[model samples]
Target: MDIATLYNANINNITTAKNAFDVLATTFGKATEAWQHEIADRLTAEHWTGTTATSAGTQIKNLGSELQAAHQELSFVSKALADAAEGFAAAQAHLISALDDAKNAKLNVAPDGRLTWDNESTSPNFAGTDAEATAKEISKRITAALNEADHADQAIEQRLSHLAYNASSGTGLDAATVKQDQAAVAARDQVPATGTDPDGVKRWWDGLTEAQQQRFILNHPDQVGNLDGVPAIARDQANRINLQRSKQDLQLQLDHLGPEPAHTVKAGRGSVENADYSAWRTKHDDLQEKLHSINDIESRLAGDKLKFRDNTPAFLLGFDTKGKGRAIVSVNNPDTADNVVTFVPGTTSRFGTASGDVDKADEMARAAKQADSTKTTATIAWVGYDAPQSILPEAAYESWAQNAEKDLARFQIGLRSTHEGTPSHNVLMGHSYGSTTVGYTMRDHNLPVDDVVLVGSPGVGVDHAKDLNIDPSHVYVARGGDDIGIAIAAGTLNFGLDPTWDSFGAKHLPAGNSDHNHYWVKDSPSVRAFGEVAAGTWRL
Candidate 1:
């Protein structure tokens, strides 16, 4: 297209983008306000009871959540489009201004692109003046203006590139992926690490348009989900989407493989078909296990009677299918809670076993509520690491814990960053090998938590509480009567010092006469102690 045609087309495009943005902004505002009002009204109404209230609350919360997500998505796209439009407009203005300046200077271009002074004008003729110098100056101004226009054009191109991803096309850049990419680009330089500017990171996150924030959640969930300085809600949303996508992809693979074997195999030597089948079976089984874990999460969120009685609602904050699989679910929204407790499981912990861990988390949540009914409590079941699959040599080593330290530390940071109003009294509670992970995390990096609780721990990867970098007084230890193996291993295996032992110098809490697995059981002394600790009411 000719330059004039291109310019006009760009103007029209900018106008269209701005108009679309305005429409979205209006709709988003109205919808969000309506959702908030509906939820508020439902929460305040006193006439509902039992199932009615439960169902209504769930539906209202879902609606509000959907509305909020839609708003964020729209906001990001609109802002991006608006920005692109403004860029194009500025470029056009620059070009126009340059042309006007040329005219004011009494400079004229012949049809063959030769420059000359306007003879008809009363301004000084180029013939007598320093014509070469004046021409050079005019040329310089025009070049700068063109350069500005070129930069703006490039900006518009970049913006359009992001907008071009659509599901209808075969480019595979769906809405979620597009959002994710945007977030990734925006956060590419702001990743949180040791010595990084945390406040600056937070400001960058806060400065993101809602769309960018949503996109970040959608695209780089693993990064955002575990990022120390991201809000809990964003993490939760991102994690959930990631989890669902993972499940869908796995299911699709399984479907492609079919329910039964492709062909009947002979019982003898391994063939290519057999190898393929074996690989497929392994993948299929792994996928099934992961799905089971996801189902457990869904059940908890749905308030299954068998899994939980409190129906406290659950929010998935992180998930992964790599290796043994990892999941993080909160019993309630941690962002608005008064107390938050994260429970990390030990050996044999995987997505398949996540249900039991989630149940334990629920129990912890209940206990916290029991300790202080007025206070809101959120207990997170953080299976966000590859735990030892069994009580083998691997379980005895510190590698697992070492590998998990950074993730655990970052998860704590995420909680602290996302929390609203006064910060929650956050506690990290670990059982068995999980305690080792928590210990390593505290030792390797600073975790912003009010307290650290170790129960039935083999060792904390440290010889004493002082080595943990946490205030000795803030470290609490409890051991069940039946955890004799863990007690013995603490000294024998160089797994570090036993926090429960007198030499470890951590506050001792009652574990009751229970087994290692029962430490978090409702009404158990260990559970009560955990409740007290989580509520910030624990005493020596």
Candidate 2:
């Protein structure tokens, strides 16, 4: 019963646990590979229509069961290894107790394995003299060992959770199958079984005058008869032809009935030539005045602000009015402007705040500027429009989405004009509710862009980036680790929440894995990656 003996036993225990972990890691890795292949094969069968619907369903169920078993095995091994590591410390405790006994027996061993202490013969107590130092060293070693064990446990747990996350989402691989099924159902519903067309031939009959409609129905009684058993396309074509004939007959009746009602032209009206000249002059004057006013405003504004000073150009636009919101443009190299980053802020963004000169989009523009000073990048803080005040009120009312569409249109027109002659790598970056704004905008307006980056986004409501009219390959998303918004979006339990960040379909850069949306620092990997997008160095 000695200190050296206990330490050696504890070391052996640790070695055994480490060996167990190694074996478990290998087994779990193989299980993961197998499950991955199974899922892929099942999907391939589904994709190619190689299996019946029932068969695919059965395969999915079986795969899920297998994945669950694999996951359980991994979890079990991880826990066992962790427990064994803890048991090693417990064995060390027993060794410590034995050492106390040996010390009480008035014996101690030196580093060279020689007996160095004899408590019975000492003038002063030898055991008490060295107990404090020995105990301190033992406690330090125990703390270090415990920390290593905890670190190892955490590493395994994180890997398991990440694997579980992937297995559950099945995003990129299954989205097309789901979309196809939904589309098929909708197409089936739109075609009626009992009628030739859903609109019906009755609509064609109803278009004529009452007498004419009745006469036509009688003359074309067979066409007016039940349309069932007729092809929908044939019925549709027949209805269209009948409507065209009825319109011609009605026009003939109108032509025959019309000639008597027009009584006169005013006697004082001038000759055609004189009157036309006067009208033409009036129109010319009006257009001239408009042109002059526009020129005046353009000249005044041009003198007041720097004109294309940076490679970036500022966009000034008004909502329901002309000329109001401010946008600042700065390029990394005024001489060789390369990348252009347009920041669209969400919810209550304005210019010249007490905290700074811009809000929302402008705030992001500032961050872009700070991110890289020499990258020949242009950061535009665009208060694209007076955005809604909050998401809650807007979320409750769907009309906000319509307004967002309009704002997107206006911003795009303005952006196109601002970049009139310049070719720069353009990115439309949105944050928070701004992402939703961008989604609606891109869907409604075709803005020329190289990349679209969403940060701290809520659900964008687009199933995919392509749904927003942007190339799916160019869409990028990032969420910080602590971002609370990511949790909200992910847990919305609705597929419409922006899945780009969590799915494999689009390129989503790593956000700091933050818990809160607002606190992700610019220095974090996610932000730096975003910065790379802004710089046009990162391919989406």
Residue 175 local lDDT, model 1 = 42
What candidate 2 gets wrong by more than 4 Å, as runs, is 1-336, 350-375, 420-422, 489-495, 501-504, 515-520
Residues 1-540, model 2: lDDT tens digits: 233544565455555765776686677667767766776565666655534855866776666555545544444444444444554455455445545544664446443333445344355655656655565554444444444334434544553454345446653134343354345334322322323332343233222222232333345423432232222223323334443453354345444442332233345663233554555555444334333333322332243322423222322222111122322323232113456666666555433220121223333333455556654554545444556655565443435445656645544443433342466677887766666667667766777677888776665666767776778888888777667654575456232555554453567777766653442354657656766677656653
lDDT over C-alpha atoms for residue 97 of model 2 = 57
| lDDT: worst 10-residue window of model 2 | 315-324
**How many residue pairs in model 1 have overlapping backbones?**
3
Q: Distance from true position, residue 381, model 1, in Å?
A: 1.2
- Candidate 2 vs. true structure, TM-score: 0.36
Stretches off by above 4 angstroms in model 1 are 1-201, 218-226, 258-281, 303-309
